[model samples]
Target: MRRREFVALTLPSVLVMFGFMLVPLYRTVEWSFERVSYGQAGTFVGLQNYLAALTEPRFGRAVVFTVGLTLVVTVVTICLGYLIATLVNGLGRMRPLVLGILLVSYVIPHVVGAVSFSWLFDSNFGGVANFLLGRLTGGDVLWFTDLWPNRLIIALNVIWSMLPFVMLMILAGLQGVSRETLEAAQIDGAGTLGRHWHVIIPSIRGVLGFAVLISTMDVLRTFDNLIPLAPQAVGLGNESIMLYIYNVAFREGAEDLGLGSAISVLTILIILVLLYPSIRSILKEAKEA
Candidate 1:
């Protein structure tokens, strides 16, 4: 295609992205250096906003929770997703139905998922958690209110929302695995575990790495679901960095856009640091391939 034709095809999207995304991102970074309140911009604050965001005790706790959530969700989602994907991949004809059912949670809106799960697990209500725990332990398990249980609920919510995407990615990778290699491994006296450990997992490490990186990032920035799950205590015990940013940026009466923007910038840097290893592994594998 000619340059004009190419530009004609992509110009609208480019302009839209520039207007909606790049403009706001540029503004956010620029505003991060200012002491802004409401609609008024105060004097240039240098890195004071960033300093405040980093040093804030609540922000510190949120960072810890975000990291912990990311780690736990990453591991759980990868393990469960890979296992489910393997099972789905081996199915002869029911794969579509099974995969579709597995992805039902993903298809639902984040808010709906959050609300549904929250209500079902509400400690006061006669929901699933109360009923099951009532029967099992003859007592209610506090799905919310309690620190550890609330954190566990949030972690489970992230995993439930993320598992389908991870599974699909791994499933696609599994599709590319060499049947000949698996058969050869089996012929060489490798058991089911041995064949998978020696061949399948290695072959799909790139996909696994990518899946893990995506899931980790998603869990780190989880916000919408968290809102419905724990709206009152967003920047508290179990909230992520993004939640804390939201709380600061749009806190009830007065918004602190400057500090929020600074925190957001710091968040991007932290995520980059956290994901460095997985990203490096993926890039190295791509280079080798």
Candidate 2:
């Protein structure tokens, strides 16, 4: 393709994305600087809003929650993905069946998947946890009734939702591992664990790093599942950065667009900061590996 034609052909998508998405992202930065109310006009707040926002206890708790969730999700998803991909890679016939089941989740609507998973762990009737509690403890267990359990359920639900993506990515990475390298490890009498830890992992380290960064970013913005199944027996009151931002944007009379925009700008910054090292390391490795 000629350079001119290529630019002309791709110009529309560039326009659409910049107009619809990038414009709002910039506007958030603009709003973050001004003292804007939901429906009322206001003046420039300068850095005053930013200063106040950083000092808020809610912001601190939200940061703690977001960081904690991201850390847990990243570790769990990547580990599960590696293990599942290893099993699938070994199985000849089982690979396709197992992969198909997981791939179907990628296409499912987030809301539908969230609701379905919620029901599976529902406190009412015969959810899996209830059934297990009935069998093991002779009583029902209320997962959402306590803070730790409730947060754990939400985090686990995110893991369930995100695990398949990680698996698919790692499977692609695993496919890139040469048969020769694997054979070399086997020929050297390296056992399965040894081969995996030394040979297989280093070979696909770049993709694994990318997966961790992507999973962490996804966890940072996790709101879809938390929204429908929120403020239950435990309480979902502005628990995470994204959730807190949503509360500031739409909740009753306290809606502050400027504040919401500030939170969003900060959230984007946080994700970027967390992603930088892994992404940079991955790029460096790709250049060298």
RMSD of each: 2.9, 3.0
Clashing residue pairs, candidate 2?
none
Scored by lDDT, the top model is: 1
| Worst window of 10 by summed lDDT in candidate 1 | 230-239
lDDT of each: 0.85, 0.81
Worst 10 residues of 2 by lDDT: 229-238
Model 1 over residues 52-81: C-alpha lDDT tens digits? 987888888888888888889999999999
Identify the leading candidate in terms of TM-score.
1
Writing each residue's lDDT as its tens digit, candidate 2 over 1-289 gives 8999999999999999999999988878888988887556668989877887899878887888778988998999899999998888888877778888987767787767778777776866358866776889897555666677678778888888899999989999999998998899899999999999999999999899889878877888888877655556214433777778877777788778888888888777877888788678779999997
